[model samples]
Target chain A: MTITLEPGRPKPMPTPETKHFWDGAKDGKLLLQRCGDTGRAYFPPRPFSPYTGTRNVSVFEASGRATLHSYVIHHRPVPGFTPPYAIAVVELEEGPRMMTNIVGCPQTPEALPLDLALEVVFVPMDDAISLPLFRPAATPAAGRTGVSMGVE
Target chain B: MSYVPGSVAVVGAAETTHLGAVPNLSEIGLAADAALNAMADAGLKPGDIDGIAWVGAMRPQLLAQYLGITPRWVDGTSVGGCSFMLHVRHAAAAIAAGYCNTALICHGESGKSRIAGAQRPPEPATLNGQFEAPFGPFGPPTLFPIPVLRYMKTYGVTEEMFATVAVVQREWAGKNPRAMFRDPISVDDVLNSRMIAWPFRILMCCLVTDGGGALILTSADRAKDFPGKPAYILGSGESVETGMISQMEDFTSSRAFRVAGPEAFKMAGIAHADVDHLMIYDAFAHLPLYGLEDLGFVPRGEAGRYIMDRNTAPGGKLPMNTNGGGLSYTHTGMYGMFALQESVRQVRGIAPAQVPDVDISVCHGVGGMFGASGTIIFGRDRPS
Candidate 1:
């Protein structure tokens, strides 16, 4: 029997290694693991801290605020991406770098100003989970500019 | 312990089945084929190899088991494209410190067949896959295309200027019977090939391939007695930068190469002018262009034009990527092993398309998207 796999669909069964991350997405929060002893935030959500040699690291919700450290306007779609998207490395105010798409805004190289303030927006996927994405926050000038949607 | 050069000499190099799509060979079979050839070439038995370094793209332990050898020292440094070159540097250090007498570095891939029904290993620590892949980045082609535009924007480089490098390398591939891409490609053909990403034509990207290659490295003292001519490891260097693609300082510069190149030259005790031939990695076309600049082959932002005028192609003053390259040659996931293998051939005076009077050849391997770097400088016993 052949089972067809749908593209862009979340896995029907989440593995134990990825369960926590998927669960956090369901609750509309970006979760990061921090070592309880050192308070150092770690990614990929490991259960142990290689730094402090401590086990049982704690997982906590990251503040939804981040600053756009840098970004690239990619025009090609790999396996899962829409063409002409922005992949940005956002530095969380809480002290760790996260890679996320700069969405809900114009996707242009000019829109990627360094250190731009951004607010996290959770995008639900197939009703099973949400991906953590960021959008430029509303500002006096941002609102006054009539929300420029594209690079003119 | 920190690695000091001079203890390593590449004694043997070999490749598995080449050309056409090969589906019958398992990944392990391909690796063993290459490893055994390298061992036979080195005039050493499998039992003589105490060190084994392999790119982690394939199953490492399976390769060891298939070869019927358990190594005293093993490394699976999978930085990306430069995996094999990096292993050479690490193995050299290990050999010098009396860790092993003979070292084998190998890579194998069945990418051609894997394309239909391959499950990529779940990525654990990579932010690029989780966050960036969901959006787009088109792998290396899409990610690296914009950078060339940025390079052109800052340097006034034309598309034709970049095509010169591609065209010349294709010409070189015509001579190498093992190269998968042997047909002559012209500058116009490169310009006219359908664009994958703006500023990057389809011709500019490497072809997906399935093959394997291996190298044997031993102490310089033992190298004198090896079966073939020895390619001495004059210098080697490695470096890593911020892994995030977007966090790089600029599109035109590879900080990893910038940091690794100067130090590699320093350790080799040579300058760019002294290099008789170069085997800079060509994961993408612009990579070699930029790498040449970082290696001081030309002034910054001038590699494309320099390649055009100097004809740094196979017959040019500085022949580069003579065995095709990652771009025109087989890019079986990782291409660094091929670069080192070609360098060994060039220095040994037995390259299928040998460039005469080769005294020193420099090979540069880049992993990730300019995220990691490993450079090796090889010198023949006598300077040309």
Candidate 2:
């Protein structure tokens, strides 16, 4: 028999500073804020540039390419997740790290190596919201070489 | 800043009468119990304590009112599990500056029973709720192990090495009657225990316990007046990094640990070889590895081998977590207070698992997952 678990995973309550980033995920685009002054991009979207403390920041679509920096296979029961899923921190090609889930792959040490290439995949929690998750890149061309140089 | 060493001292230290599980004691009760016991141990009354410090469930004012202490100075520096370590540093500074003649630092948590006002869920619009919480990072067990897996991959530390940390600490626990889990455990037992997260078996994690501890600080000049032996505060340091684990400057090493440890050592003017006893807060088995390396106790990437080689076990070159630590001892949420208690016991020649001829003890603690660190060095003798 299959167990049906309640959707216990927390959903982001978008703020004015983060609404664009969440909307971008709903539109299937990985949007990151870049500082026009320092030419540095960062994650967990904010209104001002962290480096320069300047409000001169704008959102841009990223290539959605990242490398698995570190992770753990959480076996304990989380609200919406089944046991034994990968909780990962992936370093985006734009030089920011993001806390996300590694989906579409087995959650094992042998399968998930450090620096493994990953691509963004959006999962819609509801009609008005979507969350960005990552999975192993489908093609060899989807690796680091495919990272957009336009970011910073 | 010129490093001033041994200006203040810990005159009294004590933990709640019952450690493992006390269903009757609320979180504030636990703190009060420990605080009163420590004051009695130092031959002090509630009126004598002029300063108060606390973290987590109880605020300084609430604790002060509950204990009948009208403190002129207060500090509530809540930096996760290591908050008490920072408290000690602040208390010592307050005493040295003549802000208060006597300062009491207290900690209490109903971590196991959740009897106290336990942590409520983060607000939906908060930074954590908006960014990291949505990803299903389930508390410290899931969040803390992430760096360990990466550290293992980066430094070639093995699963067995992590298991050894649990096994050796259990040996120390076996000697303590107050330890929550005192039975002996082998590396195989650790490896075979139910896995909570990859690279972390259940054995590697700290026990959920309901307990509390307190410390009393005063100027070193007045230390001899205390009924109990004084543990001079030779040095202290604290630092905070990013709140999110992903933003840590380095995955393999904690920057906060590096900064805090060196600052303490510099302030104390002591070499690594002078540290006769050490307590690295072991909320998880891998923490000692990071602590050992980052605190300059061992070279980088060598702490795993150092433990595997039996350098930190009983009858080893250096004794670590001699009270079984949070892994085998009681972890009442913020564990730094307990670590401080053990260091004081060691310095006063009263620890259950006491090491011979010990003059100095080092206690290092981590707050969140590599987010903040505090290091304190205590000595048996006052600086000349």
Candidate 3:
């Protein structure tokens, strides 16, 4: 079958494996799971650890801090996004990488530098799904032009 | 059990008669046409085949019923584009272990025409639908380039170096009459073209086209009865890393490629120096770079410079993507089939832009966004 992206902003359809993640996002918390044994954190949370396959994983609130790893300045128009938005991958401080949008700044190559410090901000799509996007971290060194959209 | 090399040989291989814009053919139509052509090339009928394997827009049962083949073994292993190479690997093992005598593998995709029925979007509950689709990536043009910026920065690769891959492959394509984009193009021409994504110009991406290819394999002892010159299935390996691009292990290289390539090379019992030809699936310009580095064909971060120096161009030390690759040739979305076709052609010394004396040819492909990989090594003669 010829696959095409759906129209409009795609929302998260949380499964049993991801319900807690969405629930935590709705509550304004960036939750991550850590291996209870190894103490290593994981993202896009699952019930168990990927490294050790241990069911002993602990869910906890995160600091919402991350660093920009890589991104693409997509110039083509998709259903939900304007052309030229930054589709970014950010490395969280707790050592997990997640795909998110880089917001609160110009979506250009010059604006989004590698290793830029970032912090998570929740944009609630609906009552159930709140997408956690990242913008420049609110540090004196980084957020000169961009302001924090971090929800209290 | 360890995979022994040279037990099976691909006696027949044929691509669809019409490659680009075959609007008259549905996905199933293309696959059947290629299957029939390969059968004819092998001097056999559909009834002669006892084993069946396939992946793409259609299922094996449908193709089997359409071709009227009652098979003893059926492999529907579909991971991604490189699924065919994995099929080759499994078919060899199946044939070696006395599971099936004569095996047929097939691929067909209507990437551009979309003649096939509408495909369902990734289920919202799946890993990709919940994580990746929400990011608004329209297609591969957006998804594939996500890791390239990190690769360029980490390896100190220049824009000119990246564009050289497209340029070098175009030179090879210029010689192949079947290639879609035949005119010679320059690096600046590629850079100056329309940008699909950051660091990727239109020229750097693969052409969306319609195509299908098939192969017939059997034990080397039975291969002599076939009409086509046998390209021995020397060795093969398959592996996967992640479903989402975010968990690709490293942005600068492919973990799947690193694992699959070495396994194939080790199984083939040949050093890198022994490789006479190569076909690295180029879904995007950056793929060959990652393939080269991860496959150990070049040192770390040397692929960009290597291509820029025309090392992989026509008459270069290593003739790679000699069929113009998915970049200049037709990209049927699942480009691994075309890459396999080229490797078989070069091994048989029948490629239009044929490299001379290709004793060993390596065909490597990536499925999804660095999620899975399959490597196949083909040799001209069966190992003594």
Best by DockQ: 2
- Candidate by candidate, in order, the iRMS in Å equals 5.5, 1.1, 0.8
Off by over 4 Å in 1: A1-152, B1-5, B57-59, B115-126, B382-384
| 1 or 3, greater by DockQ | 3
Clashes of 3: 0
Give native contacts recovered, as a fraction, per prediction. Answer: 0.19, 0.82, 0.79
The best-first sequence of candidates by DockQ reads 2, 3, 1
The DockQ value obtained for model 1 is 0.17
Model 3 - which docking category? medium
Prediction 1 global C-alpha lDDT: 0.74
Q: Model 2 over residues B176-291: C-alpha lDDT tens digits?
A: 88999999999999999999988789999999999999999999989998889999999999999878887777889999999999999998999999999999999999999999
Tens digit per residue, CA lDDT, model 1, A1-152? 11122266222234565568768887888887787778877665557874596996888888776777545565554555566666566666566656677776677657766567776787766576566778876552343222211111
Candidate 1 chain B least-lDDT 10 residues? B115-124
lDDT of each: 0.74, 0.88, 0.88
Least accurate 10 contiguous residues by lDDT in model 3 chain B:
B116-125
TM-score of every model? 0.77, 0.96, 0.96
Per-candidate DockQ values are 0.17, 0.74, 0.69
Backbone clashes counted, model 2: 0
Predicted structure 1: clash tally: 1
How do the candidates rank by lDDT, highest first?
2, 3, 1
